[model samples]
Target: MKRIEPLSAARRGVPRWLRRALGPVLLIALWHLVSITGVLPQEVLAGPSVVLTSAAKLVATGELQQAMWVSLGRALAGLAIGGTIGVSLAVLSGLSRLGEDLIDATVQMLRTVPNVALIPLLIIWLGIGEAPKIALIALGTAFPLYLNVYAGIRNVDASLIEAGRTLNLSRSAMIRHIILPGALPSALVGLRYSLGIAWLALVFGEQINATAGIGYLMANAREFFQTDVIVVCLAVYAFLGLAVDFIVRTLERIFLSWRPAFSGT
Candidate 1:
């Protein structure tokens, strides 16, 4: 006869989404408690309610929407430009020994230097305008995608290459049909990383003579000690990051539907 399982051994009844939400909920509750008790002063950091109100005000005044659009444009432009350069260089370096010898070492050296450290030089070269900001973001985003794409190309299954060889596939056909598909998952991961880096780079870039954008708003708020407004800008940044991450996840699901792995149940 089968034995009954103990209650302690049963799976959780909580929904997956609810379980995920619980942690943030608990944190917010604890924060509210401390805030109401005056353990956390508003001068240092505004409480959640104040931050929410500030966000609403910004939204109503249309300032937040205008700022968001400007920031989004910069981030997307940088991502597009950087992604193209990264993919081209990765393809070159990964495919030919001569290309690797010429390009890889130089890229590796440059990658060692922090992108943020180049801000002053970028400003000197490109000026304290949108040009410098977009260039900085592009520079910051390129390396991650380049590295991942190169690795992915080099790591494509040898057996698959042999199979293509047996089929007498042309070089172009082999790359188009076999190598690119094999490398795509890694490229997607790199894209995700690059997207994150783009946002970070934008934050730094916007701090330099920016007339608009979330970074500008935050900087302006700091002058008046508007902690609530600062927090609102921070939250906007976070929400945008999360939104882009979710988009990437959706792309992975669409493109990698054939690949399967253990889901940590």
Candidate 2:
């Protein structure tokens, strides 16, 4: 009799839950081993226990909460501004060739330049304060929103537009009835993507000019060899990302309830 392959059997027969659990189990074990071995510098990367202790200290003092609020506020404000402007421009561009040509090249050029490269110029212009940080966040988020919205609008089914025209629907009515729904799913995807970039930009901004917030905490800790504080900062950053993503997922479900595929998942 031919021998069956062990690898194929494991791959096919193992439960997904077990597979997922195994990854984290292996990662934690590796992390524990690395911490014990001192391969990575203790100052740069503390073990789990040190991170947790730092977290507890920051929590009791309310420093953690304040940093979260500062970072979150910046990100949310940028999202609102960028999302609104991107959607508005996308609508205009979709309706008119003149708008499309005018808006397209300029946005494309701006998107190519890294946001961090603009920091020096921003500091010179807006000063080393909140304005530059907020502006950076907005800049980071705007392009993704703009690109996704514009693409979604442009790719709206030609047949649908023709059908609306055949039925003698006005331009506004056709856009409202047909175009909006088709394009909205993509817009939602862009919104989620932009929010992630906004968080990253906000963290980078804080690391530079700010005296407070998690990024600043990390930056300062690095200067003083306080690895535990650095670990706390990273934990806070990761936790916030998870919390924001959960909120976005919830919003996606509620707002896009009409999407049957998502509902099934």
Candidate 3:
């Protein structure tokens, strides 16, 4: 049998941050080369420089700021609503087999359904206002949270539960001290997943009759054939997703510090 070193061990000489950035650095270099080579029409696929220039213009005019705030508000609002419901249901299901049996089947069914597919029905029921958009984001975010949270809770070590019972800890005390802490890592994983889906859902929701949002900006730019503006909108979406992931990762490092596996060291 051949021996294979772990990637971290194999790359021990490389700085972790530099290694992490290698792919993106290469991708950008390739993009710049393609743009300079004129292999792709500039009008059809604007380069990073052109997109950055357009972003600067939009920022100077405050159009990007206004659209971003509206989109941010919608995303956050949906996340709050969906997150609350998800955590509550997950806790309920975690606390009892009866609760799990009652709620899990419906969640599993709905989780399989695409949130984007609900747009038409949501629009019909909630009208073309912010309600449908928020609803769509909520639907998209809820399932990831539920699945991860339920799994985290259910997977808590049985030995820990027995130890808590030996210590004669009350139900609430056991849950608070043992289960939630054990599940924190998985729950944070769910949070990261949900954040990504929230943005995806927001994009889908805003595409439908949106007057303000990154999606709306992209839609308007398409009408005027402004490739640069379209590229700017996509760049903004990418940046936002990265930002959300960073925040959640930071939270994990902080909250899961007690666990050596997750510690910042």
lDDT of 3 by residue, 1-265 (tens): 9899766677578788998899988998898889989987798788878878899999999999998889989999999999989988998988799999999998898889878778889999999999999999888888889989999999999999999999999999999999999988899999999999999898899988999999999999999999999988888888888988999999988998888772232
RMSD (CA, angstroms), candidate 3: 4.6
List runs of model 3 lying over 4 Å from the truth: 1-14, 262-265
What is the full ranking by lDDT, best candidate first?
Answer: 1, 3, 2
TM-score of each: 0.94, 0.86, 0.92
RMSD from true fold, candidate 2: 5.9
Q: Model 2: which residue pairs collide?
A: none
Q: How does model 3 fare in lDDT?
A: 0.90
What lDDT tens digits, residue by residue, belong to model 2 across residues 146-239?
8888888889999999999999999889888989888987888888888889888987888666977778777888889998888678767777
Question: Which predicted model would earn the best lDDT?
Answer: 1
Q: Write the per-residue lDDT of candidate 1 for residues 191-255, one digit (tens) a residue.
A: 99999999999899899999999999989999999999998888788889889999999999999
Q: Tell me the number of clashing residue pairs for each predicted model.
A: 0, 0, 0
lDDT of 3 at 46: 88
lDDT (C-alpha, whole model) for all candidates: 0.92, 0.83, 0.90
